[model samples]
Target: MDKNRMELNGFKWPDGDVHCRKVVFSSVIDMEPALRLTDGRAVAVQAGGNCGVWPAWLAERFERVFTFEPDQTNFDCLVQNVPENVTAYRAALGSKRGRVGMCLDTRNIGAHFIDGKGSIPVKTIDSLKLKACDYLCLDVEGYEMPALIGSVQTINEHRPVIQIEDKGLSERYGYQRGEAIDWLKMLGYRVRHRVARDVILSCAPA
Candidate 1:
């Protein structure tokens, strides 16, 4: 593994597991907003809820949480794991609004995507018109860029701290990795740190 890349635990991401259980953005970091979730009305928007690890964790800190997942199996598991404060949606966040076919990752539930023969509905963040957001976490395989593009209005309006998995750029998942960073920089968000598979970026004031 590259020195900069994190070493995967064999138990959590055993070898030969093509899409292991290792990609969701859990709120394990020590960021102030994330850590201080109990104080404010933290609203979290999760692009890919997966098995609901992030949403379950976020529900403890934030007042309200919104999570979206395209895969039925994963969505079902997510709904079961999260609390009542967490609102789960069955859809994909993309650059546009409509249905598309998503390629399923049989091994890693978190690695599913709307790539080919997706057959899933894709919607933009702008369409939801959420009132406010304190933290935004995205992990939609390699489709983070389109999802981020569709979230321009939300990002600008809410200026919520954003965390995105730069997988597509480095791996064969979505778009080029640098695309996500460049877009964030263009939007005035700064790279706060990297945790596991995602880079934590923040533009909203701390």
Candidate 2:
């Protein structure tokens, strides 16, 4: 087996030689936020775990990690890569509870969402019955808005620091740019930083 291709097995962009790829495969997209976190549980949505790198990152720092991924193909590998402290769930998260269609991008396993191909059940974060969390990471393509809607109670109650990918709005998945920020601000969260393709929000005093 080709080692390079093996590296690309679960990667979002697996096309060219590893050295030649435009974007490098990051075990965790951003590190500063996680590095600054001192303690508490973390919740990671859109677990298209591409080697479970991000989840593993969370597990290493937080007391416990709860991650969700609806794609079976990605879930299979995700299950194998997470640490014992990380709980991996094979489900989609949205504003409401129900099943929705998932569009899978074969070229990039990490891009799967509830817009195309197959149908998957979605659950609300409020239903998780979580008592508290310190960090929240969302990368569910364009479905971040609905998922955040479902997590309103959690956000207000737990006040976890939030990070979300915001590149899919123009692609027509679900949300628009700055939409999540507006919702988060309404919940007493402020923009911590806007870097690259992610917007980091924190529940700090205004």
Candidate 3:
């Protein structure tokens, strides 16, 4: 049996110094994010899932975890470390369904994104069939906006708790920050918890 451990919050590899604890958010707010996974039956979508550390951990708690990463090197690492329950895909998620050129930031593996001055393949969340994700984690460099846009159907269907990395990097990737928040709000998701550069959004069951 593998030993289970919990570290404060940190990056997987290559981007080791990007500590989750050190993330700085624009606002100081505390809203309880609900992670109701007592049933042990939940789906997940980990866009830009680098090394699968967080999603792998969630797999231990949930019955099924699905992760995605476009980087080949990171995908290899994910396969080695992720548990059997966690399924990982080597592809990028976007507003459309197709392959797109990607940029590999060798220095900061976590910063990799779609290529072409800020573009990449896009896949709709509905097409991924991730309808009941209990927890959805997004760490895509600057493409978070498009990923979220493509996931509108899924968000409306599952209303899973989402943790997104929000900074000023969106503009670099041809996106706007306000658009991301507005989209989530349109889907009835509210900010549950925020820590530095990360914001967790959740929607209560109706």
Candidate 4:
């Protein structure tokens, strides 16, 4: 591993595994505001923050930011890189609020956890009562649905612009990318941007 890179338990998937070091953001994408966060007095949530790069970077531009990751090794790295404005949680965010087991891929630490398996301690976004979040980012492997389900209340209340990774990996998890998009549309979000495998959704203020 590189001296600057943090090591964590790898991620486990149904098809394979991956050992993720850290996520790097494009300078252009990182600088643009997803919604109306220009004044920087916005709340943001980053689900599945691998090494805190995105969240930490956004925290520098936003007033408040929150991130979640269940892997202990990743959490340790997150604590080191995340800014004080960003609150980092060493727990998974799921549809339900309870304890669950999170599977780790020994090879790629970033690919950890499947939707139904890897049960670990978690809190639903509804329980958080996070209102008025300007931006939301989710990259929770195949567990994106459950995490979105948990954040229904937050999404409806805050109407945050969401940036999600939606590759065709749904087949590996017995789901479809359309299904996820449909669910988001039903929740009143519109597809704002599509960058290869990534999908960004935005909704008007409620």
TM-score each candidate.
Answer: 0.79, 0.81, 0.76, 0.79
Is candidate 2 or 3 superior in lDDT?
2
Per-residue alpha-carbon lDDT of candidate 2 for residues 1-206, written as tens digits (9 for 90 to 100): 33223444354333322332334245365745644642454444434444466777777777778888787666665676678988887888888887777776766666556774446778888898787677788877777888888988888888888888777563475456778878888888778776678888886653
Clashes of each: 11, 2, 9, 20
TM-score of 2: 0.81
Best by TM-score: 2
lDDT agreement with native, every candidate: 0.71, 0.68, 0.66, 0.70
Ranking by TM-score: 2, 4, 1, 3
State which candidate, 1 or 2, has the greater lDDT: 1
Model 2 backbone overlap count: 2
111-190 per-residue lDDT for model 1 (tens digits): 56676544688888889898887788887777888888999999999888777877554355435667888888898988
lDDT of 4 at 129: 84
Residue pairs in candidate 3 whose N, alpha carbon or C atoms collide under 3 angstroms: 23-196, 23-197, 24-196, 24-197, 25-196, 31-192, 94-122, 94-123, 96-122
Candidate 3 residue spans exceeding 4 A from truth = 1-41, 117-122
lDDT of 1: 0.71
What clash count does candidate 3 reach?
A: 9
Q: How far is candidate 1 from the true structure (C-alpha RMSD, Å)?
A: 7.4
Task: For candidate 3, write residues 38-134 as lDDT tens digits.
Answer: 2325676676667666666667667788878887767766676678988887878777787788766665566677776333345666687764766
